[model samples]
Target: MKIASKLYRTGAFLAILLSSAGFTSCEKSLEEEAKTFINPDDFFTNETQCIQAVNGVYQTLYSIYSSPDYWRMVDLGTDVAYSIDVNSAVQNYEFGSGSNGTGSLWLNAYSGIKNANLVISRVAVAEIDNTIKQRILSEAKFLRALYYFNLSNTFGGVPLWTQEIDINAVSSLSRSSLADVRAQIIQDLTEAEMGLPLSYPSSDIGRVTKGAAQALLAKVYLFGKDWKNAKATALKVVNSGSYSLMTNYDQLFDVNTGFKNNKESIFEVQYLREPTSNTNTRTHSQISYYIPQRDAGKRTYAGVDFGNLVVDGWSVFLPTAKLVSMFEPGDKRKDIVLGFGFRDQKFTRFPKPGYPWFGSKFWDLNANGQSSGKNLYLLRYADVLLMLSEAENELGNTAESIRWMNMIRVRAGLPELAASTTRAEITNKIFNERAIEFVGEFQRRFDLNRWGKLIEAAKSVAVDNPVGAAKVKPFHQYYPIAQEEIIKNPNLEQNEGY
Candidate 1:
């Protein structure tokens, strides 16, 4: 799950605002060039234009994650993974009094939310074809809900803005009650599910689908501890037949394969290597940053050579020893999940001595020494399965719980967990599995917090790492709301103990 951070700079938000305003005019001009330009009020006169507008919404979604603060902060803040020295400031918890707090995950998520709001507000009033208009609005709603889901999870109750709010008119906004925020999220997702199609054509694979909406709704319900609703929505996705678990677990993240379009993927941040069309290319795909070999010649696009891995400076993400130990011995997923090694112990098979980073499997080390970029998978079928098992166990459905848990374990080449397993036992197993499965995919902190184990976990592990010992406090569970935001919005009360 993504979190909010102070990292969103005012300049970046201003840039987006200017760009969106400019696009409105550019779009008008382009339409006129082809004798297709309609009046501002008349622009959404047809389905094609409305659909194009919806595509713009997705474009915004794609751009948000590419920001440095969002991915970096999320990867480092979590417990399942750690960043190496290369990107240590955030990973090492050494984030100082910078313009933004720590990294900028917080600001970027809100920026995405703001952009979604712009789309929803503008598109709703446009005179577009009804079906297309509704669909576009639904997509915007889904994206907005996703952004809020990340925010609510990270910061608890946050300022809930439905339509676009005028910054000048509203200098201060208070955090809404968590209940109210969750209600809005459910409402947005519910609308999205009704409007979205069960699936999309191959060309539209990365766009949000009905299954994606439902899966996300299930997650929202699960986090809110609405067990029945979570179970029901998850089952809807499963029974809809819109997705299936990939036959090979490893294939879900295989760079060579079109992992973004894989069967198991429900929602993914889409990035393309070479773009012939404007819609397909990405500027900040993960492969460019994570791939180790700087001089590897085979290039689909110009890859950034960060010069010899600046061990502490550039290679920021590293796997923690605790995470390494969590993997059961002989588990095939252990190697695939954490690259070739277990903790600091180097693997004789695949060794990189200087910087033993966490996410090696995500690299596309081809025989020709070329690599396809790394695309992050935010939601997948396996996650849903694990969630389903979690909800079932919480609801006291022992048989159903075992069935789901075993499904994932069986796929990972592990024996089925027995039905007699206690809820605590099953929960631990599921949590461990999630850690390994999602290791550097950026999901550790959320898992620990949701399990109510972050403080304890951090303290226990502090014996080896001093930062963990010193910084592990109850308040650390929720990231501090940026001080600037508080000054601007007096309604925003600081989280207790912050």
Candidate 2:
């Protein structure tokens, strides 16, 4: 009950960055006041406040992922998801340094990192029990590492800050090398894995755990092309006995199925449909952008009254036909993942004209368009298994790789591949499997970039939406630094091409 009381107020910490009060060097009175103000140092004196402080960092995640513009930055214009709106800057890849989508994501990520740094730096001497202190510190590290991981992937070696920055020193900071960023991320996650517990009580289900840190470390390794470390860390999670695949694939994202924080979830951004107060970020969550516009009780379509799963959505990101064809003939995941061409025509009443393939992963019958409480999974057990397979094959362990890959395939109701399969074949199979399994989950663009296939994939899917693809060049592997940010900090440089 107390956690609920404090959790809703956690989002108030965002005011540290969002406040409109200008910081000016000429205002000596204000600068002196800022120095004496009771900040995280004075605020986190007790356990309850420490819990609230960490909750603030978690609150930043809602703003990071829930924005429709965020989805446009990551998923839209990719091979798996497309939008027809040529005027949409992000979808069409015509956005320049002034793009708000890129700027918001950049600022939101740093805001989270800044809050986590406050916790990590202040909680050390907070007069709490050693166990509780370690837990809080580990959680902070896990979150900070996550923010940096996303930053490095998106903008490539963004400014790295492990401690709070004074307003006067903000513009002096410059970008760190990618290698340096990766080193810090690995160090933070390694410490997190050591300090985090394997599991928590039901009340603390969404908190980061030992498995989550290890799973994310494995992903970081995979991104850096360190196959040996990637496999080692991934297998650590697989053999840890902490997670298992849910029996039914569809239940993973089905809000009606009561599987929001199931065994498969390693890390998730927790959201609730109903908030305890007006300030709570729980009610701020939104996944409606994935739904079809007129379908699901929004209006009559194809002369049929399709019932609402969630109403009045924009259907901005529709599934691509190429993604629909990637699934094998007998894979059950296809039916659950894509609602486009099903025999019952569940996703859309008319698939011929719009060819809408809306995501069925996050549906709740009781939801209004914006208040859906579906948790956005950051890491899952299935992703771990697939990554393990990928790392194993890269290290010449084709047999072991197939064994790991088969676990996922068997659960998907498809026949397993042969153990005698070559390394290249198994690697490609795992790649394609990830493409289909995690299509609507915001992993496509990053996956393609890490695999060094972004340019090729964009070209291949050019015909799907020519106007958008024509603007996607090889330089687009990294988004340009926002003009606002560059103007604020002269040290910040734009990526190669605007």
Top lDDT model: 2
What is the total number of backbone clashes in candidate 2? 1
lDDT of 1 at 276: 24
Candidate 2 lDDT for residue 168 = 52
What is the Cα-based lDDT of residue 247 in candidate 1? Answer: 78
- Cα lDDT of model 2 by residue, 62-176, tens digit: 7777766667777776778777565777667787887745647887788788778777877887898888889999999999999888888888888887866565575668999
RMSD to the true structure for each prediction, in A, is 7.0, 3.6
Candidate 1 lDDT, 435-487, residue by residue in tens: 78776554667777777877666555452344654565666666667777777
Which stretch of 10 consecutive residues in model 1 shows the poorest summed lDDT? 1-10
lDDT of 1: 0.64
The residue-level lDDT of candidate 2 at 331 comes to 89
Query: Looking at model 2, which ten-residue stretch has the lowest summed lDDT?
Result: 17-26
